[model samples]
Target: MRDLRIGIIGVGVMGADHAERVVRRISGARLVAVSDPDLPRATTLAESLGSSSAPAAGTGDGDAIRVIEDPLALIGNAEVDAVIIASPGFAHAEQLMACLEHGKPVLCEKPLTMDTESSLRVVEAEHKLGRQLIQVGFMRRFDPEYAALKQLLDSGELGRTLLLHNVHRNKTVPESFRSEMIVRDSLVHEVDVARWLFDDEIARITVRAPKPTGLVADGVLDPQLAVFEMASGAIADVEVFVNFQVGYEVRCEAVAEKGSATIGLGVDVLTRRAGHWGGAVPDDYRARFGTAYDIEVQRWVDATARGEIDGPTAWDGYAAAAVCTAGVQSLQEGRPVEVEMARRSEVLG
Candidate 1:
């Protein structure tokens, strides 16, 4: 079989990383085209990958990679068989619709869309197409540690998990990163984790914050607490601290009737110094979850070659947006808010 011809939209941090991965690391796929609002950035990435990279096995060399000025044109490009959307959240809905219209499979980076309604619209469109054509980029599901935890939970070894505790910390944030972004961007991962691990929907949510870290200005909750009540009678509490100033760290612990399991305590080699014993914390998420991203993209490439999606779907994206909607509302109102979501059957049908 010929290598899957992949085009990536958005050459920002995540998009550029994905483009390099496709050209250099991933098998059964080749980077053929890229598009972004910043034409110079996209052109630079395309030229660099096209000129320097060797073709993957089974994919003959000398395929010309181009920079399409429009993301929709990239989606509709004849040589492009699939698309990876690393664009901003606000741009996702339109680009996703274009992919569906062109019958191109997509691996859209998180947020799926900025809000629940647009996300559901994508779901509805794909459902009407009579196939699953979109996969939301929830990379954590592909992480080895998280996958192991999931397998253990599924095995009944954990014996009906009752509580899940997650800690999401970032070293810093851009000035443009607003307070609501803490819920929409960072904590959204925990929301999906809760739904995925428990195999249930979030029933209600409440947001509370302690004193803001002195480093953060007023009105921004540097560290916040979010409580999610799942439909399965389980609870998942997430502590999202964007200005932790230490390093990027994500930890999850599952408490079950029989026992408990914790992961993400830094898997690097431990050190025994003159007086200290410790391990290095990743400076950012890219350092921490690099392997997971590779696996996720490669799996998507493999599945799209077979006319299928191997990971989270558009409904999963919509559900995540639904929960985050309630979360942001709770954060604003300073009260517990019941999650409102349409049944899958209702929306898909």
Candidate 2:
């Protein structure tokens, strides 16, 4: 099998994990180089991947990965056949454009960008490139349970899809995290999942803010509800609370004419003592979705090696961004905001 040379543009938590998977877990792809603003961190990660310090002619050496300050430089490097954009959301547009310009396939993290207009620009660029070169990192779509649920829905076992309900809760996020609202940070996943499950664009969105739970009074944002109307007339409700004390839990259910199917939360049992049954809850996003992330990266690597864009496309990213933008509006207005989706171009397909 020909190895696909890939380079990651960020060395942060998620970026580092992608590097690890590329080197250790994935067989179709090899970590050719890694670049971050912090050269020291990049070099350390490269060394840990069993690469050398001296950069090779085409690909970097075994002990060292090419550490560069400019992410665009990584995209243009001869060694990097594909690029993974795990940098900050704000930097995604520029990095993605560079990759597409170089005709390298790219797997970018979710939201695509902070706003819809920027996301549209990405879509436009991919359209101009005349091929599908961008895959947005919506990992939940690759989750086993979620995939099962989608199959069930598609099989018509649940009868007419009338309503969908989801709960996304985080133990807590920092106070400074409010820079991005619940729509961008917490509810964005729900937005993506709901759309993917229903295979429809959200037509309307409304946010209902309930009273804050006592457990999170330190300006902690908890329990935000978003109601969505799908283009197919399906109604979906999502409750996102970042300060839910129980554990990092994600729950979803689809209500249909005959019956409903739901996803289980947490592990079966963590401990049985004192006449009590307990199950461990994940501490953060990374833990809860660790398996999903692994599957996502592997799929991306495999698909890229096959010269195929297998995951979420640029259209999905733009649609999510549009819905999220409307979600922010609905939260501000405290009313249902109608979302208008642009026509999908052939390039996006």
Candidate 3:
């Protein structure tokens, strides 16, 4: 069988990483094309891989990869068998619709469409097709530690998970990263994790901001706390600090009826120096979750090759968007907000 011909949209940080992974690391796929609004960036990425990358199975031309100026054109390219969309969140809905129309499989980076309505539309469109073709890029589900924790929970070794505590800290963010983005971009992951780990929908959420860190602008909330009440009566709390001034750190501890376990402590390589003991901290998510991303794309490619999606679905994206929409409302109003969502059967059936 021919190797899966993959095209990537948005050659920014995440996109470029995935493109390189397809060329160098992943098996059963070849980077056939790339597209970005910035033509030069896309061209550079394609060229950078051209020499080191193997040409796709049927492309007899010496051209290893094509740089398409338009994302839709890239998606429609006959040489492209599957697509990886790392475009900005706002572009997801339209691009996803195009993928559905083309019958192409896509692995899309999250926010999934910036809002609940668009996400639901994508979900409905895919549902109408009677095929699962879209995979939301929530890479944590593929992480080794997270996978182990989930397995432990599923095995009944941890009994019933009662509470989950998450700590997400970033070194800093750009000035344009506003208050609500912390909830949308950073806390959204926790929302998905909570749903995944507990297997329950969030019933209500309340966001509370602590004193603003001097490092951020006046209106931006540097550190915030979000509490989630799940449908199963489990509680999950998140502490999100986007300008923590420390290395990137994401830690999660699950409290169960029998025991508790934590991950992401970065203690795998602890060191002892002249009366001091510590280990390296990841500079950013790219460093911390690099392995997870690799596993995620590889699995997606393998599944797409088999005409299936083996990851988070469009409904998962819509659910996360719904919770985050409520999270933003809670942040703004300083009150508990109920998560409004359509019943799964109502949407899927």
As a TM-score, model 1 comes out at 0.97
List candidate 3 stretches off by more than 4 Å: 53-63
Q: What's the CA error at residue 332 for candidate 1, in Å?
A: 0.5
lDDT of 3 at 45: 78
Write candidate 3's Cα lDDT for 1-349 as tens digits: 7788999989998899888888877888888999999988888878777766344422222357899988999999998999999998889899999999999999999888999999999999999999999999999999999999999998899799999999999998889999989998899899999999998999999999988999988799879999999998999999999988878999999999999999998988989999999998777999999899989988998898889998888999999999999999999999999999999999998
For 103-150, candidate 2 gives per-residue lDDT tens digits of: 999999876888888888889988987788999999999888899999
Off by over 4 Å in 2: 51-63, 213-221, 345-349
Candidate 2 TM-score versus the reference: 0.91
Per-residue error at 281 for model 3, in Å?
A: 0.8
Residue pairs with backbone atoms closer than 3 Å in model 2 (clashes): 51-62, 51-63, 51-64, 52-61, 52-62, 52-63, 52-64, 53-64
Candidate 1, residues 241-268: lDDT per residue as tens digits?
9998999999999999999999999856
RMSD of 2: 3.4
Report lDDT (Cα) of residue 159, candidate 3. 94
